[model samples]
Target: MKAKLRQLFRAVPDTWKTSATIRSLLFIVLGLLIYLPIMSDVLPKTFDLNVNTVSGVTLTAPVTVEDTEATEQARAKAVRDMRPVYARNDAVTVHQLKLVNFVFKKVTDLQGQTETTPDAKLKDLKESSPFALPGDTMPALLAMPAASLTAAAQETNKVVTAVMQKGIDQNVAREEIQQQVNQQLVLADLDSRTRKIVREIAIASIVPNVTIDEEATNALKETVRRSVKPTMIYKGEVLVEKGQYISEQVYHRLDAAGLLERNASYLPFFGLAMCAGFFVLFLAFYLSQAHRDVYWDNSKILLLSSIICLTIIVMKITSMGKGINFFLPGYAVPIALGSMLIAILLDTQLAVICSVLFAFISGIVFNYESLLPVDFRYVLYGFVTGVAGAYSLGKATKRTRILQAGFLVAIINVLTIVALYLLLSSSTGWRDVLNQSVFGILSGMLAAILAIGFLPLFEGIFGILSPMRLIELSNPNQPLMRRLLMETPGTYHHSMMVANLSEAACEAVGADGLLARVGAYYHDVGKMKRPHFFVENQINRDNPHDTLAPGLSKRIIIAHVEDGVKMLKEYNIPKQIIDFAQQHHGTTLLKFFYHKASQLSETPVSEEEYRYPGPKAQTRETAIVGICDSAEAAVRSLASPTPERIEQLVRRIIADRLEDGQFNECDLTMQELERVTKSICETLQGFFHNRIEYPDDKQVAVKQA
Candidate 1:
């Protein structure tokens, strides 16, 4: 039965197994699995209660969690315990004393006015005193003799000054102050008339000298808030005891704690899955429309999917274990590291797309425990920093460029963290701000370090021709490249010229110029095996083909492609470079050997035997390199090549390839071929330009002993 199952699974076709759509489907299913568990509490919950409700079943905490309501209540109590703030108004007491002196002077002047009637003088004194008193009290003030009135005024001023010095506050009412004044007046040694007048003056002089200070009060409340620690409900604690009534408040607490029966809704799970699907579908659409090459290739799809999954897995791991997140938040997951790797290994545009998609994924994955399930602050931080990493490492051809990009990404991450952190909470402490900023910077550097570590693995396993890999292959110190130079020095020089021509042409046609250049460097690696078999390495000025039969010469010439393929496979070179070695000659016939054999043989020769086994050039870069290889050899054999001759040679080479249908498999257009011809001709002209002749004595001479 196990064998049958193994056979059944193996029966699937290789094409289906390597399908990008299947990989995307698997990725979507994995995303749904990751989201479902975290989304349990996010699902909608409805309680079965009108006003009062009884518990249908007992509830218990599934995990240790904080009771938010109770914590808020405790904080509120802490704030309430704080005392109200008050500030003493020294100016109030001084101003009230000054008013008392002014009023007593006015009263004394009225008592001594000789020309005015007592009734008129009493009216004037009442209005000038600025004190609230009965009309009868003002009239009675005239009955006291000047000597008694002066004593009363003096006593009232003394008592008012003393009372005002004690700091009367707004909390004490006017009636209470008046009662205290009346008691003090009764204790004074005076008759009823003088005591009553003094009591009235003393009461009016009293005013509030202390008032509520709003800023100080708010500052105290803030201090209390900051001191209140988080309150939590322990794991497995009793949420509701047996036979306990489920009131509205109790039901809400259970619901908020994710323990209520109504919290089991699956709608949110479905919605979250759909949201994830939307992002995946959007990425698929983007790849299909914008980068058809990446979308169609299964290896690239697998790599992309693997990178996204790896990044998210890392994010999930770093964000695990609740309390530890204070040092490293969800935004510190190093998403930009993945983006930089993708940009270096793949396309920059694809890296940007991955950045946006991962941002959304990060927001959802990290916000599981938050009240709001999607925290867009993390999304913004991840997207901006990831894009910065990708864009900063635009054409990363060296390993150290990744480090440079990491520092740039860290700066952007820190900036984004500061902006979002301040926006979310203006009152955040400098210590917390500094902590999050450190995490942001560390996230960027960690991402770069991880990318550097994992880059070789992806390149080797996938056989990707990244810019760095191409640069490495182009180095003259490489084993194969060095062997080619030592064994076939003439072919090595020819390859360099071809590389220069191909690189210029490919750039003009908007193809992979680096790929073309590197491919040209290794195109003739097979010549290293039998260096003297080809004409270029024949240093003795003797043609080996002259001594051999035409059939043998043709066979020797045609065998280089096969030998090169074997050497490339043995050395584990990427297929992209090997394509140039195999397809550089295409299926074109060796005309010289074929005609020579037909002239010597009794029977006509078959063209198929002299032709190269080829799949043709399968890309624009490969096609251009093949054309340049033939053009450079032909141009070098010219008697006196000038601008016109070089142009004609290049045009003829391209025209021959077009006539022979060598470019049929690739997507090289007629217009692009014209552009390549122009660029190659201009470069060749400059490479073979004339040099100035110097006088024999003026030029530095070397003796060849």
Candidate 2:
């Protein structure tokens, strides 16, 4: 049963490697997992309550929503408080002033009638007047002297113009205007009867000059209504206290907030779905554009999805205890764990993108008492911590470096949390600050511990060669490296030179330099099988190959490639390292052995038999290692090499390989190849530069004395 279960587990990765449908399903599952935490509040928890009832428990709004009834009431009140708008009609004032002047002119004309008696003139004046006067006032005006009459008429015009200029509304009574006119005429230089007549004429002439503007009044009320904001039932706001009476207002608030029993709305679900779908699509698009290898590989896609889901799960769990008589539990979420793991096991650029995605997801999961779907505080904290972890772990070559990265992440977390608290908090408290700081520190440390524990598992299951693992394999104390050192010291030393050349060249061309270095270290472990038969290991001894037939020599020389593959497999080294041992000597002709064999046989020798059995260099690193391997051996053959010879030799090897089509399998460009050539030449020149001779210690001491 155990063996069958192991088979079952092994079959899963094979399916993932071959199936595109499974890879797409993995992304779909990731989107659903992201939507899980926010699902809790999408459909709010409802309570049974009515007006005038006592509440059993305190209820907080699960989602933000508009209180429509309350908003309407607020708008109605705003309209009621707004004052009416009025407009003045200058045309009415002008007409009233003209009538006043005309009335006085008619009085003067009637007084100038020579043939009419005073009673007839008075009757004529009354007939011509625009308004009626008191029974005795018309006769008094006619009987007055011309100077007094003119004075009264001028005073009346002045009083009418003054009263009308002060915008009298239709609501103003005529009695008020009469009283104001009486006061203005009291200082007139005329008899009391003439003054009374002037006052009545002025009062009649001053019609109401202002009127209510219905359009203006309505517009003012509308402006006031629009200025009033909608009444909102914010998320996590308390609608009713424990054991408090559910008044009509509180009951309506609960109903509007969806806390009272009602049909659930699907709008929130649709909104969350859209958000999750958009995020997933964005992540997929980023990977396809920036890291196509990960996008095309099912195992890598699965690994990325798993890490994001696991981080989100941790965040969701942390958010469950949020606001449990505390400021926040979100500070304890190890959001950086996903970023650090991706940086160590995958691409650092991908890790950076994942950090931002994780931060946003955290905001959604921990959105407590927030007006927005995402809480910016948690977003800021998560982004800072996750990015710190990723950048700090980018160059980690040792296991303990993960812990050190964790400490750095902790420091960043503490600074971020404290800064956010101080910036956002209205009333800062020392105890809450201390608690949040502690949580942040612990969160970073916990992320590190978890990363350390999970790194090996991920590497083992997915067959990934992280920098840390490659560094571990490069150690001289490893079993294969130790065997190579003890059995063939000459080959080991030669391998080190090739490692330096390969690393420099690969780095110059934007390839994996560390992988190239590690691969170069074990590239020649096959030479240890028959140490003395190879040229490098044969010290102080006659050449064994000179005694043997050329064909026999060729067989022994080519056996190392096959022998290296067998031994590396038995030792369980990573396949990437083994590829170096296998493919570094691609299918180029072994011309030295082939020429010697052809000279002895008196016939043409088959070039295929003398060539290394190869699938060719399948990656830039392997191709670069192949070039460096040949270049190093060639330069070392010179008795005394110079910079010119080293440059010529490196370029020749690269040109020969390119002409032979050995680099056709990899995506190495000519520009990259040229860069590799330059880099290799510079490195070899440093290695083989001339050195000055030094005096012996005894001679130096004698000269000094």
Poorly placed runs, candidate 2 (over 4 Å): 1-26, 45-262, 427-430, 541-556, 600-604, 642-644, 690-705
Which consecutive 10 residues in model 1 have the weakest lDDT in total?
Answer: 1-10
Which pairs of residues clash in candidate 2, taking residues 3 or more apart in a chain or in different chains? none
Instruction: Give candidate 1's TM-score.
Output: 0.68
lDDT of 1 by residue, 1-705 (tens): 433433443355658546867767755764664465445434533435322666665665544456777778888999888878988777887787788677666767777778999879987877776778777777776667778877877788778766766667777988888877776676688987788778876887788887888999999998888788776654335667656787766766676666655555556677877776777778778878998887777667767766777777777777664346475657578888779878988889889988987787677666543445566887898899889988998788898888888898888888998898689676577788788889889888888899888787777766678898899989999988888988899999989999999999999988999999999998888888877888778877688889999988888888888898889867778878888999988888788998998999898789988888897888998898888888888888888889999999889888888999998999999999999999999998998776787657535454322
All candidates' lDDT scores? 0.78, 0.85
Error of 1 at 98 (Å): 53
TM values, all candidates: 0.68, 0.68
**What lDDT score goes with residue 170 in model 1?**
74
lDDT (0-100) at residue 367 of candidate 1?
A: 58
Residue 91 miss distance in model 1 (angstroms): 48
